[model samples]
Target: MKSDVIADWAARPGRHIVNLSGGKDSTALAIFLHDKIPQIEYVFCDTHKELPETYDYLDRLEAFLQRPIIRLNAQRGFDHWLNMYGGMLPSAQVRWCTRKLKIEPFEAFVGDDTVWSYIGIRADEGRSGYISTKPNVHPVYPFKELGMTIADIERILETSGLGLPAYYSWRQRSGCFFCFFQRTGEWVGLKEHHPDLFEEAKKYETERGGEHFYWRQRESLAELEQPERIAQIKREHALRLEQERKKRPNRPLIELLGAVLDAEDDERGCDICHL
Candidate 1:
């Protein structure tokens, strides 16, 4: 049944939408599908707490696709929802952020309409894509079905002149700057690359009910931002990257960065936001 998606995608009775996360796989999927699915609508479920690089990458992708990438968001931003949760910063164990900032708004956008959600999960990925609870919204994995791998994704992006997001240089996942899923190295990268955003993330780390809520477990942004801490993280990251590079001498720098970051901690990030 899954094998038939590509053949009848156009004839399917639903609105087709490719959800972009401003990441390589999703962007490449959009590039691959734009000409094939003319009426396909591209969308980004903006948490509004994302990096500036993410928005810029989306603009470039929009131009390449020559289609408007619909920007969807919750009625209120992250701050509003954070307050609603009583200062409990969303962690892996309790991620209220994904539902409030992403999925809910996406569901609202479609509003009971039959929709085909295009996901970019590739052949190499074993993880599932965003399978909506809404019966009307169906997921179609073109990359997986087509046996497209990371190499294919990178090729597509490179060919389109819309390479990976600028954040890719340091961060693998593209979500909130203060995403609890981020590794210590990524936090270091955030501080070095986008210090203001790093500071903004720090503000969320607060003491509520005598317990300090931190994005990273056992560590606060304030602690992570210290000069010695930053240097330590950088040194550790460099060492890890060197080991990974030695393992795959021919791999691209971006891929190496991903490997090194994942080596630090591979939580797979927020499934919905990483899409």
Candidate 2:
């Protein structure tokens, strides 16, 4: 649907909301739908542990939107949840983080209002993100209905003067600084780009009892930081990129990025946080 058409939907009396995840797709969607949905409420479920780049991107988006993107949080934040979980750290198998940090806050924001949530799942993507089961919160997919693909999303962000998230240079999705869904190479990038955040992530893995947990099941940040391991991960990533280029020479760099991440680790990222 065109912007004018969607504008009509936003012009209605009921609450219209868009959740920004600080990721490329969601950011693009916010930019694309901003002028069209003049009254639409924009929100971000802040985990309070996101990368600095994420916060920066949100600020840029907020300026572009010309309004506050409401920040939601559980009464306490990530540290509170981590302490409650005995500092084990959240993984795909037990994603208490998403439920507490993202979903609950979003639900609380909507409250009893009948909200129309606009999601940014592209037409090319096969999987669905978080769609609230709340009877009052209706989810709508403008990208899907309009058949907008990855190329279209890039165009939207490019034209709107809000390129891509800074993290896109290494990481694909946006979430917490130490999201378990990150690839090994991206983890390396994290260390190189933001060593302090990397160290903070490492600190979360160790506890008072001397017990240690890791974001990746097979590796720890200390081990991953080894020069040899970092070199190996870089080599593997380079080889994978070369192989991907051979397989799909005509695809854009974005598509190649998705493929590379899938090849390294296919864990589906947090929908509520990454959109």
Candidate 3:
């Protein structure tokens, strides 16, 4: 059934687009379909708040694809949207960021044209892709149709020479530097690696009089960065990593880190931003 849908889309005459999220799966998907879909358009929704490493990775990918990966920017960036929503930082519950920064720009890019949006969701994963509600936009998952998994994605990247983004060593996924969906350990990683960006994230948590808006629902970035808190988060993460190693001794450290982080907080991230 999946193969039939994929085949049908391949034969259909329309615009083909692959939205790159600067993550491994999407990067692999771009490499996977580069030759197969010659007319396929690759695009990245720039939040302008993305990590430097993300931008660098995209630049490398553009070189590999030998075509420009169109960068779609929200008319206004994160700070502008943050103010529009009364300084309330976007959280998992109220993710205006994804809607405004990612989906809207993507929709505007496609306009009314019939589009087949290539999503990099793998067959081993059960999560759904972010299919736009726009009637003209259709979502297609080649990885799922081909039954490709993490190992296949790794192979694709390795062969392409693009490899994974530098941030993958500490942070498993790529979105924003201060994405609330991040685990405690990832937050620590951000603070350690990008203190300036971490400080900027801290500034978002304002306590004007009595009203408080924090990136993390439980604690502010300032509090999270405290020595004791950072130590505790690292210790807990290390314990989980050891446990995962016992269970899957042959698993790569990066994969194990992702699994441990997921176990710590299994909240599904915004597919548009994280995929």
Candidate 4:
């Protein structure tokens, strides 16, 4: 869609919505389009299992927008869906969590209305996030329309004084703390930064029928948490960082780390959760 398309959609008053993920890109988009669209409805689909930093960042964003970011939640949260899955935690291959917990609630909230759902996907990115299959709900990418890229998004957040979620210090994407998409280094960061939350995530992985159900397939959180395993993950991450740095000597180490980690992502997870 072009910038004029979004502007035209904003000119009408049916329903103008922006779904906030408490992630950098989404939050930056919210601020970028704040005054551009009239009566824009901001929303967040809470999974009830997000990191504390995510919640805090959302609250701060609400204050910045001076408008309520409607928080949508599944009628029944993670526990209910987990029970329906027969005690099996959601994995990338069989990701029932994003559908039931995030997308379903957001779609239901829109109902059958003609909704112009403004997404934060940038012009430089080439991937689609969650789009409702409902005929009435139309997906619009204002960031892409405006030719905004990651550098543009960073400027948007920087100018708004909401640079990035504090979680960026350790983790990259904002989603469920126990999201299986997380890398080994991110898990280690979680264990070091938030030990209690790490333990809670570990509790989610359980043994059933002599087979362990883990967020990440083939490896339980218990095994991942061992001192030796954590050290090995860190060592591998450091080597990867060094390799990336050698390739792009001028790039900042932080940006290099993000790129290297992103390269390792198998791209099997839902954009709804990660976006």
Candidate 5:
């Protein structure tokens, strides 16, 4: 079925696209197919709420690819969507943010055309791409089909001169700075690196006359930003990193950090947002 889908898409004269997430995997996939698929359209569904590093990484990737990456954006943006949703912040269980900010714009871009969506999910990952369910949109996993792993992705980025986004040094995944999927350590990283954004995220959390909303399910950002809480999170993250390093002494720092973060929060984030 995979081979048939690949062949069918190759034979069709429809849209060929790769959605970038400003993360390593998607950037590597874009670089991997830069020469192989000249007609491939690279796109980023800009939430307009992503970290500055994410935008910088996307800019670098565009230069490396020597092509424009179309930025798909929601007509109203996050603030508008939040209002429409009754100021209820999106959570893992109620991920209306992904649907409004990412998927809707992507689907609108593809319209009714038969699109072959190239995904960057690696063979080592046990998750599938989150793409449009529309019958016209066909999802394809190039990295998985090609048997590429995390190491292969790193090699691709390195060879292409587009290494991982700077955020990887601290946070493992990529999405909005205030993404609810962020672990406690990542939230601390945000507070330390981008305090202004952290403040903005905190502003989002409010009682609003008896309705309590928080980015994290258990605690509010205000509470998480406390000095003692930040220190505790850092200590826990350090312990995890130490344990992971002891387990895999030869692993790359980036891989080790990712493993630690995954161990911290096993939930695989929104595939479209974090790929």
Candidate 6:
């Protein structure tokens, strides 16, 4: 991650873009690079299924940067694709949602252009963000290149006055409210914080031709919302937090919450969609 490499990308004589997910990492990346790359373009692929807080966070980021964030929307939209695929909801295994709603719109926007796509993955993160297959689209990692971690990201947001999204108080990842990657506790959080949206997510659970489809594996939102089930999830989450606190005391609650969620399931959420 040489400084000259980054400078070379900056002077590539093409589009320089940062894709925002309305989450902390990508938001922090945008703020960090606001002054560095004057020609940088910020874009967000709107699936029309994101949480209300994510949309609000983007508006604030736009105002802070003093630049317009180009929002790309798919022509056919989510519902059309869902119906075309026989109502099978997108899962980690079959991420048609990411393809149709997120990646496709982004690739279309940078058609045949030698674009430098700035990704927000931290150095601590083991996975890479979504890299387009298009030869013209080159991926760049500023935070990773600088060896920044979660603490560094938090400091950037705090200094910029754009702290974590409001939903981070409950849900950690920022994507569709009904993202299939959601853990039991996040599902409970969605129900508690945004009940109407929670209800909307529940409507998608269906038994199509005797094949049950739910956001959470082996559990439907209706089942997860049961008072007893929610209590159990809260109890388990509390125990995890208690254990994590013993290892690292005086850490931020948001950081603690994110660690606890990751311990529940090691499967990293979508890099691009949940950045």
Instruction: Pick the winner on lDDT between candidates 2 and 3.
Output: 3
User: What lDDT would each prediction earn against the true structure?
Assistant: 0.86, 0.86, 0.89, 0.83, 0.87, 0.88
TM-score, cand. 5: 0.94
Model 1: C-alpha RMSD to truth? 2.0
Off-target runs (Cα >4 Å) in candidate 3 are 1-8
Best candidate, lDDT: 3
TM-score of the candidate numbered 4? Answer: 0.94
Candidate 3 clashes between residue pairs 3 or more apart in a chain or in different chains: none
lDDT of 1 at 144: 86
lDDT tens digits, residues 165-234, model 4? 8888678878989889997678888899889989999998888778878877758889988889888888
lDDT of prediction 2: 0.86
Candidate 1 overall lDDT versus native: 0.86
Instruction: Encode model 6's per-residue lDDT on 95-196: one tens digit a residue.
Output: 999998889889988899889899999999888999999999989898888889999999999999998899998888988888988877888888888999
Poorest 10 consecutive residues by lDDT, candidate 2 = 204-213
- The C-alpha stretches of model 6 lying farther than 4 A from their native spots are 1-6
Q: Model 5, range 224-261, lDDT digits (tens) per residue?
A: 87888888888988998999989999988888887878
Model 1 residue 94 CA deviation in Å: 0.9
Error of 5 at 238 (Å): 1.4
Go through the candidates in order and give the clash count of each. 0, 0, 0, 0, 0, 0
Candidate 2 residues 98-158, lDDT tens each?
9988888889889989898988999998868788989998888889878999889989888
Q: For model 2, state the Cα shift of residue 251 in Å.
A: 2.6
Model 1 residue 52 lDDT? 93
What tens-digit string does per-residue lDDT give for candidate 1 at 1-275?
54366658977888999888887888898999888888899888888888999989999998888789999874578888888997788989898998888888889999999999999999998888779999999998898888889989988988998877888878888788888989878888888898888888888788877778888887788888888988888898899989998999999898898888888886777667785
